[model samples]
Target: MQALVTVQHPAHVHFFRHAIGELEDRGHEVHVAALDKDVALSLLDAYDIDHTVLGTRSGSLVQVALSQATIEARLVQLARRLDPDVITAIGGLTAAHVGAALGIRSVVFTDTEHARLSNRLTFPFADEVWTPDCYWHDEGADHHRYPGFHELAYLHPDRFTPDPAVLERRGVDPDERFVVLRLTGWDAVHDIGDSGLDGLPGLVRQLESRGASVYVTAEGELPDALADRELTVEPSEIHHLLAYADLFVGESPTMATESAVLGTPAVYVHSQPLGYTDELADYGLLWGFHGDDRNARGAERALELLDAADTTDWDAHREQLLAAKVDTTDVVVERLLGDVGATGTARTATARADD
Candidate 1:
């Protein structure tokens, strides 16, 4: 099977990395087309994966709209050249729309509880819409609900193992209590802009008071006050650090989910409405809050959760994850092959599973 994977954000690169490799190992030829975001390109390089650059631009809604024509033309050309058996889009809407327009079978992975504006444009058009059970979006019974999150497919012990050498490379001491703080600059619906910095000082101070070393990373630049501990490592390496960290505090859901799957306690605060919080909170692994909730003392609250956290049930969570392990790459690849009437290649696809 020849496959083309489309990625919009850096997080989606990580999300599809293992899946792509798994597909290729099974004898499927996989090609990646992506916007040249700094983090996304960095991760692709770090992993030594070959991919074509679609284009580069600010990730604002306006930029997304403006780039549609260019992106579509590239997708059409790539599809003509690659002639993939299937196309899987990591970023939800854009990939779906382009893939569908080209008459290619496409799968979109989304975990949002509610539909974003993009979903309205793309979900109905996708060959398949894959979402975590926590996702509540439905497009007239077309969406397919998966039992797990993307974080689990990658972070589950069955698939991922953290390397402490990543920490060594970042000049972090293994003995130190590491706390990851993710600062977000993109908030379409809310003004979660630089004001997150206002709470950072207090949050950092509180964590420091507890003898925790705070490390920050952001989509945009961090404030001068928090730059001292800012993470400068490659994107893929950040995941390993989160795995080794004692706790994580971020406004990014992807990081929060990554931390939780790695057994790190996480508190994600942002003003945007979050749908996965309820499910993650139930797992006893994540805490969530709106950025504007002045009463919500995230740092103090994080410490309280950390202090009271009982890992007594972590084994159960791990067991649950293991039992539900769905090699997402394999699932999607098989489905794609099936869609293109490549059933005669079944024995070949199964052979790739050995990898």
Candidate 2:
């Protein structure tokens, strides 16, 4: 089988990296195409995944639309050349459109229910729209629910083992209490009205007051106050450092869930309430807060968690979560390879015949 996988964000690379390798190992051909989002192309290079650049994200919403249209046109041309049996992506707006134009199958995966605009544009055109079972929206008969978070596609024990060398390389003591903080660039269409890390300097001071060292990472540039704390680790190995952190305090749900999946307690202080995040909180693996005062309240909550870190049986919570979730890469590989009840070629034939 020949497949085309599209990645728009760095997380999508992680979500599909293992599946791409698995497909190739099984004698199937896989082609990767990506947007030049933060560290996305770099991550692909680090993972040694061959990918064609679709286009770069622009500074404004209107420019983003124009960029995507250009990217979609390029994607359609690439699809014509490859004649891939299937096309798949995370948000999948472009993939769905290309598939529809060519009468091919497009499978989309999304865990974020709050991506309303992206979802509205992609769902009606996709052949299969897959989300975690925790996702609460109903996109009608095409919506398929699976028992795993996107993080599981790579972080599951079967796929990853945290390296202790990450601590040693950074000169971090294994016994030290440290926090990993992530901040995202509020540039996406969904992030228009939302805010994150309201007072970056204040949060750093508060974490310092509790005697915990903090390391910061962001999708955008760091402030002058945070310049000293910026984490400069390789994109592919940042998860190893996150796995060893005492706590994760961030604005990105993707990082919060990644921390939780790696057995680190996470605090997401953003205003978004994603279903997977809510489910992770239910499992005691994450704590989240939002609203106008989330920064102050979130800091207080982080202090509380830091104080109780010694007594919290985090491994037990992680074990329960692992027991409840399936290896998501298995689902991705099956769906893309046309083993999810209908092969891509079969679906393409049916789609053409219907016309």
Candidate 3:
């Protein structure tokens, strides 16, 4: 089948890379369009996924709207030329818009309930809206709940295995115990009111006092006091690093969930409550805190986890978490290909248009 997939973030690349490869292996023609967000383009390059460059994200919401319009115009032209059987993306606004204009099926996969504006814009136009079962909000009949998260699409044991070589290359000693801390820029619309950890210098000192090496990753500028603590690993290898960390303390829910799924304990310190993060915490793989005192609470939780003699139970907890979730990529690929006929064209297009 001919498919067009749009990627907007670095995480989206990881979420869809495996599925794209699987589709190609099954005799499908796949085209990728990506915005220059963080390491998104670099990842597509690293994975050898050929793609077209969409517009980059602007700093302000008004500029973002202008950029989106430009991107949609470009996508309409591209879709007309490609005439894909189906279009798919994570929170894909352009896919939904262009697919509607072209009378093609658009499949949107999302896990963030707090992406209020994006969801409202994309859900009505999408043919199918797939989300994790743990997602907090309902998007009426179009929403299809699955038994897994976006992270599981690539991080599942069936799809991924952590590499020790990555650790050695990062100059981390094999026997060293370390913590991974992530700080996000809070530049997204949903993050407008949210705040990350404060007093990083104090936190690092506390983490080090517990005898654990600290590795930090940040989205925005790091505070001068914590600049020296930044992690220098390749963007693609960050997950491998997370898998071996003793603890993950972060305000970025994506990395926290990634670490939790990798059998490392994560302390999520943001104001918003995410369904996936809450669910992971329910399974005892993560801890979540919010409100004014969240930073303090998160710090305490990090210290508590660090002070423990062993976190081996995290592996057991991870197993239980995995048992309850399906491989999200398999689900996505099946949904995308199941209705497409053997001729590599969507048989349901006309029927869907009629409906």
lDDT value for model 1: 0.70
Question: Where does candidate 2 stray beyond 4 Å?
Answer: 341-355
lDDT of 1 by residue, 1-355 (tens): 7888887778778778887887778788889988776578877887888999888655566776777768778878888888876788754565677677778778777776443566677777787776665665455555665456777656767678888888998899866777888877664322424243256777788877777788888888877888898888777778789887878888777888788777777787765545566677777777777656632577667888556544345546645654644445444555655642254333332333222
Query: What TM-score goes with each of the models?
Result: 0.86, 0.94, 0.94
Any idea what lDDT model 3 has?
0.86
Root-mean-square deviation of every model: 5.0, 4.5, 4.2
For candidate 3, write residues 218-250 as lDDT tens digits.
877788888888888777899899998999999
lDDT of each: 0.70, 0.88, 0.86
Error of 1 at 72 (Å): 1.2
**Candidate 2 residues 272-338, lDDT tens each?**
8889999999999898898888888889989888999999999999999998777888889878876
- Model 3: residues with Cα > 4 Å off, grouped in runs: 309-312, 339-355
Error of 1 at 151 (Å): 1.2
* Model 1 TM-score, 2 decimals: 0.86
